[model samples]
Target: MRGGSGHSGRLLGEFRRTPLLVPLSEGDDGGLMTGWQGGVRWIYAFTDEGALARFAQSRGAGAGTGAREWEYLSILGARLVDAVIPTVDGPTGVAVDVADEDASMLFPPVVGIVADAYAVDAGADRADAV
Candidate 1:
């Protein structure tokens, strides 16, 4: 499910517990975090082709539709970025970037969770596997 602002820890915890695939980034806005649950994968400030494709497929939207969803997703993404980047502990300066092509892939279970959450938030009657 979607979470409110200032709940990055909780959201990150949920992502870890559920084991969803999350990409963490550090940019001018702040720390950015994006994850995939179910079929839907979200990209915050970073745009990876693979991640975008997966998120689109889960939403049952063509490439075009998926692009549109990014607009809304980015809003939440910005908050996530701000919340987590500062907390990351490392010499990478907290505002690190983890966008490896192979690493971008989400596990199946995590994909399911993301998709389920998306459906619930969108008020879709059911979830669809992409």
Candidate 2:
């Protein structure tokens, strides 16, 4: 997966479309924001690494304050893998092979993962303080 050092704004935008797993902490760069999603904490590092490092240090005194939110995404990635297992049989209950096996398996898992991620993110935010 891509590192979270320079895509904070894009990450924030992505998270905003879905519920965040944690409260969003904005950095001075204005483009970056850290938040949680799907029982995972993330560092939306939009700017360069230097900027994000400063932001993490700024938030003083917390057990998991400096954690990156992308860690949670990694967990979701595994779940996504599970959700994409191929189906042996077709809709007609006939034995058949499909060319785009991976894509077919991915569809439901992708949807479920997104939904679950949103729910978990919202729930985590409500339970904890950013």
Candidate 3:
């Protein structure tokens, strides 16, 4: 248990420090968001690992072909992720786009993208609390 917790921490830290461009692809998780304004396919340039960890966990990758449990990152450099959006009504997750960017450096082979979305409640429910 201790090792698992420590690893997550390490991963979280690594994600935050690396200036990597994570390409997010809407997976089959079935996000709840609806009627968004922009493209769902987004290129989130995050310097925060904690957010990245959250994104990785949300997909429920289920330990792919590897020693790592809950493996999300594929050797191909692109992983599938759920697309969640905050609308006027509430938070919803689905397949979407973010309009292609000229971020050639952020593309595959150079950088890796763990496709996933915001797992936690993106709605008012989380704020309401237990």
Off by over 4 Å in 3: 1-18, 21-37, 62-130
**Candidate 1: tens digits of C-alpha lDDT, residues 12-77:** 444433312233333555333444434333443324445545644564656663344333233233
The deviation in Å at residue 1 for candidate 2 is 25
lDDT of 3 by residue, 1-130 (tens): 1333345445433433444334334557533222333422233433334444544455454335652332222111112222212221232222212122221112211111222233232222445444
After superposition, the stretches of candidate 2 with alpha carbons farther than 4 Å from their true spots are 1-46, 60-130
Q: Estimate candidate 3's RMSD in Å.
A: 15.5
Model 1 per-residue lDDT at 26: 38
- Cα lDDT tens digits for candidate 2, 2-115: 242455445434333432121233455342133443433333322233333343455542237565542212112323223312221111110011112221111121222345
lDDT of 2: 0.29
Could you give me the TM-score of model 1 versus the true structure? 0.22
lDDT of each: 0.36, 0.29, 0.31
Q: What lDDT does model 3 reach?
A: 0.31
Q: Determine the backbone clash count of candidate 3.
A: 16
Arranged by TM-score with the best first, the candidates are 3, 1, 2
